[model samples]
Target: MTNSENLLEIRDLKVYFEVKGGILKRTVGHVKAVDGVNLSIKRGEILGLVGESGCGKTTVGRALLRLIPATEGTVYFNNQNIFKLKPSELKPLRSQMQLVFQDPYSSLDPRSRVGDIVGEGLRVHGVSNRGERHQRVLEALRMVGLQEHHMRRFPHEFSGGQRQRIGIARALVLNPSFIVCDEPVSALDVSIQSQVLNLLKDLQQTLDLTLLFIAHDMSVVEHLCNRVAVMYLGKIVEVADREELFRNPQHPYTQALMSAIPIADPKIKRQRIILQGDPPSPLNPPPGCRFHTRCQEVIDICSQVIPEQIDLGNQHFCACHRRQPVQEAATS
Candidate 1:
């Protein structure tokens, strides 16, 4: 059973990409890619990070695993500060934290056999000998619904869904406690997407894995995640339990995102929120709330001061200056 306690705790994590420019070739400014993101994921829980393109959803996931180093703040994985670990100390931890890349076609090595590709992690981590690694690779492939005979083939030989299965097998071979699935199903056909999603869900339950599933699809998040975070620009504007946020979204940006999701019932129509203007450049994000430029319910205070995340009853959180506590809003 999941401990219901924090498996990963991230506080004020900031990841900035430096942009060198100007006539003198100086570092003029930085792209505030992931600014002060605070979140915690419990053991075996899947936290869905959803947002539009360039919203830093992928950066947050990558930073947590130190694929890209954070500019500031702390990342605690199972109570150990991940940033503090030396190169040698981190080698073993690499096996525990794995990543499933978005593009299956390009992720695997063309020269390597499917079996060798999956077993590479086992070999790197010194988990077993060559014979044992081969066995583990076949087992991982089977877990993802692929036959052992297919292990001899190359990544090019499989369909998109099968390639994704290979990617999943690669991650699972390490027996990771945590996996960052960055838009895992985005490249596949709609039909294949569901198959991959179901496979992930089944694997999560069976392996007791913790996941940070990043995607732009709200429906995908709704189906797979227990809690959802909405990101805009470079900041997380709202986060809450999946059901509660969908039922009562306090942030205007989040509401806009929810409106875009197609409802199954034809009678239950939702007004699509179309925002004017493109998202601000990460090199220079807008002052105060990054979402203020496009928010429908903007106020003067939103432009002057950055809103702190407020708990709006039942664990729902929103970072909007105009937001009232859920109880207060209900009473009024």
Candidate 2:
């Protein structure tokens, strides 16, 4: 796709944390949290980043917002390289790109009133006038199906769903173009999860917002996202349109993940592909294809060489030796 079509682009994104050892606290190794991830989010579409826990899905989201420093890579927001910008230059852009955190309980300050929490961004970005900030906060809360009075109370007074709505309001109050929703509904009850998801869907449509929705649930991704990217051990294994990926998952990892999604109909039995072994530690990940150890479809090349992301028509891409063309695989 053209650069003009995308609101955000991440190229070769890698975030590694230093692992200290010994009394001197010297660097022993690195935890490759997000390694060589490349993806793009369109102007008004939700792209789901799905993987098991510790797969670096959250790191990618934080890196996009520059919440944590990246070891290497470039992130272009509106064609501007965010990593190249100075602190002063980046500060203003923060309002345009916001994050809705996973846990509402911890994300919100207990001591602060809802109004202050939601309007904190406005205050930081120079909405100095209290009346204006209050009005904006009220408008945001209303959009999330919350009343004006709810803002006067503290976070402790609200239910789990309301607190999440408040968190969403905090992100929305800034009138952001792009939002990194870091599993906004994961902590809530199943019923509450649907409510929060619906609210997000409605808000995205109403506000024309682009979202990088990070989640482990395939069913939720299928419901909310326009496109999906499957991440495995800090690398994206596959990317495709929502319908296409759900209908025909190419990578073995992607197929295994898709198999775990519970089908509602009891009559229609689906075979479950249970992945063997645990995920390799990020501190010392296995060579070549990270999923090769657990993947049932074993090939000699998979253990020896990294697979290139191969295009499979209709905007679908898979990074798997098995998915490569027979002639291309033979040549390699």
Candidate 3:
């Protein structure tokens, strides 16, 4: 509701990559990977970021952690802007924020043992004693449903699920207050995916951690996130509580996405919405409404004017010409 309630607040965030051409390596143009996004993660809540591939969801997560340099905008963690801090100054604060990478196979070092992999963070932050680090590592492993015996083995020795557990263990070892879960379940088997998601939920409650869970699957978001944000072409088209967004998607792009989610029952038939063409390249996005090209409900002004983020009741926000803003809620 206010800045005090938010653990992380993002304002007009933008990340653009320069397109180079010729042997001279001149800047031909820029790919607006993350054009302009406004989001906030409340303390101890899982905010799901869902979108199609190449929609800049991963880019947004990476930019928040400063893994990649941002083109513009600010990220405030605990009311402090992170990009302003120097590397040395930022290093200490980094321990409070961590990332669980998508691919557990490549994320872990194959050459290193699990103990060393998980304990490395503690060592970096100066745990100082071997005994304490070992205990902490074991506790973290146990928390993620892994045993101390497995700690002695290398990444190559473990299964996909086990490796993922190791990765979670590594993040948990830091005792971070905030984490970016970058599709942590996408690489696992369907059955194993639920296990990992449940493990994360358990860890979140146990640790009282704030999470930014990014994924392509709507069902997964519905299961784990408190609120879901739908991204399309570097912009958040809709954001609402999991039930509100899924049940009443306002944006055309979001509706199209929701329609595609397969239903388990054949007894009930649902209308399917098929978009006309692929999303336009980020380097040359549409002048006004990015979705106008593919939107079935497009109006005359849809292609000429940028739609404002109209706040529907109950903190539900959507950008579309057909949706009217609720005067009671804040509009941006």
Rank by TM-score, descending?
Answer: 2, 3, 1
Task: Kindly list the per-residue Cα lDDT of model 1 for residues 33-130, writing each as its tens digit.
Answer: 89999998989889999999999999999998988999999988988889999989988898999999999999999999998899888878886677
What are the per-model numbers of colliding residue pairs? 0, 0, 0
> Clashes in candidate 2: how many?
0
Q: What is the clash tally of candidate 1?
A: 0
Residue-level lDDT tens digits of model 2 in 225-281:
999999999999999999999999999999999887788889978889998889999
Which of candidates 1 and 3 is the stronger one according to lDDT? Answer: 3
Which sections of candidate 3 miss by over 4 Å?
A: 328-332
Pairs in clash, predicted candidate 1: none
Report each candidate's C-alpha RMSD, comma-separated, in the order given: 2.8, 2.6, 1.9
Give the Å shift of residue 308 in candidate 3: 1.8
Cα-based lDDT at residue 73, candidate 1: 93
Structure candidate 2, residue pairs in collision? none
Q: Please give the CA lDDT of all the candidate structures.
A: 0.91, 0.94, 0.92
Report residue 145 deviation for candidate 3 (angstroms).
0.4
